[model samples]
Target chain A: DAGVTQSPTHLIKTRGQQVTLRCSPKSGHDTVSWYQQALGQGPQFIFQYYEEEERQRGNFPDRFSGHQFPNYSSELNVNALLLGDSALYLCASSQTGHYGEQYFGPGTRLTVT
Target chain B: DQQVKQNSPSLSVQEGRISILNCDYTNSMFDYFLWYKKYPAEGPTFLISISSIKDKNEDGRFTVFLNKSAKHLSLHIVPSQPGDSAVYFCAASEGGAYNTDKLIFGTGTRLQVFP
Candidate 1:
């Protein structure tokens, strides 16, 4: 079974531009969460979505937003990106009620110039 | 403030030896702890986890030990193999607290198993 999958393996954007990244949850999973990992640093939580509604969020700013579709797929959008936004964006999927042990997808590398 | 910390940035161990990676957390609210293995350019893969109620959990050659009193957790890999070399990260969740599934992660420790 394909675990979790993400689109646009790599992207390049200039400062002030916007970008969108996508993710498909694992089979039989209903929750999706996004994370940002800077070079040489561990992933920092972005937000989590369940039932097409945001359930939790991290310390990210308003420019970072996300959407969850009925199928449990997800999208992470960043507006007015800054050079500091360049990082690896990761998507993780988990079944609700499972104590939050998530399975992750190969992240998308975002390069903000 | 960093909630979780993996003080060792890197470690080198001989193959077939036991590799112990350590982690400590400052948050008492975390009730569940997990260990993940990550390769360069790839997302982390869940390895093992232990709840606050349990002190240890073992799977194959991987064993995770949690010391609640010390607010510390560790992953032990016996008979370490070359394939086991990777960056290992420690993650924690608050369980039902705040009714969210947010996880806080540590900076990670790189393990290199030499054959």
Candidate 2:
């Protein structure tokens, strides 16, 4: 089966602007989680959504938010983007409340100038 | 604080040899652990996993060993292949379901296998 997929494989934005990244969970998956991976650094969790509602969030600021639609697709919105926000934004999908595994998407590379 | 840790930033091994990647977690409550392998420009793919109750779990050329007392886990790749070269990530979760379990990940270790 096709795995998780994210749109706008790469994007360029300016500081003080807003950007939205999109993702579609893998087939048979319900929960979607967002992660930001800086260069040469491990991924840090942003937030998780299940049943169209956010369930868990990380230590990120309010400027980072997400939404899960009824189709199990999701969107990540960052307002007032900063140059530091430029990184690989990965989207992962797993079965809602699953104990098994999580599948990640190819990720959207956001570059802020 | 970073709950999961992979001290080795990179490792190199000759093909057909064994490769061991180490990971230590500070959270004692974590009961499940997993390893993901990622190639450049791609997302991480699940390699193997082991529950806290078990000491070892093997899948073909991959094996994961977990030590509850030490709060450590290691993945052993036997007879490594050139295609196995990638960044490996260690992750852990606890109390799955009930909105209690969230997978915490560590900084990845890059592995290079020379043919």
Candidate 3:
């Protein structure tokens, strides 16, 4: 079983440009969460989606938005990106209402120039 | 302020030795604690977790201990091997076995098991 899958292993974008990252949840899972990991730092929670609606969000700004489709897939979008936005974007999937470990994807490296 | 903290930036231990990684948190609301191992260029992998009601949880050679009063948690690896070398992160969640809670992660400690 494919645990979790993310698209665009790496990406390069200019400042002020928008970028989108995609993620497919693990089989039998419906919740998707996005995280950003900066250099020398741990993964920071961005937001979590369930039932195609955002259930919770972290301290990130509005520029960091996301969408959950009916297929249990997710998309993370960053608008007007800044150089500081460069980081590794990770996607994690878990079953709703279950106390289990989250399955993480390989992550997408975003470099904002 | 960092809600979760792994003070040790790196540690080196000989093979077949015990590797203990420690973590501390400032949030008392956190009830679920987890440890994750991460390799370079990959996402953090869930290692083990302990609920607030439990003081310790063990799986194979890995064990996690939690101290509710001190807000401290630790991961112990017995007879550490070379393959165990990786960055270890401590994460916490507020609602334990109740609802969906976002995970807060620490800076992480890099463990290197040498031969």
> Predicted chain A of model 2: TM-score relative to the true chain A?
0.97
Total clashing residue pairs per candidate? 0, 0, 0
Give candidate 1 misplaced runs (Cα > 4 Å).
B96-100
Q: Rank the candidates by DockQ, best first.
A: 3, 2, 1
- B37-92: candidate 1 lDDT, tens digit per residue: 99987889999888888999999999999999999999999989999999999999
**Candidate 3 per-residue C-alpha lDDT over B15-108 given as tens digits, one digit per residue, 9 for 90 to 100:** 9999999999999999999999999978889899999999999999999999999999999999899999999999999878643578999999
Complex DockQ, candidate 3: 0.69
- List candidate 2 stretches off by more than 4 Å: B97-100
Candidate 1 chain B lDDT trough over 10 residues, lowest sum: B94-103
Ranking by TM-score: 3, 1, 2
Candidate with the greatest TM-score versus the true structure: 3
Cα lDDT of model 2 by residue, A9-108, tens digit: 9999999999999999999998899999999877888999999999999889999999999999999999999999999999999886555678899999
Interface RMSD (Cα, Å) for model 3: 1.7
- DockQ-based class of model 3: medium
Q: Which candidate wins on lDDT?
A: 3
Error of 3 at A41 (Å): 0.3
* DockQ metric for all predictions: 0.54, 0.55, 0.69
Q: lDDT of candidate 1?
A: 0.93
* Residue range with the least summed lDDT across 10 consecutive positions in model 1 chain A: A94-103
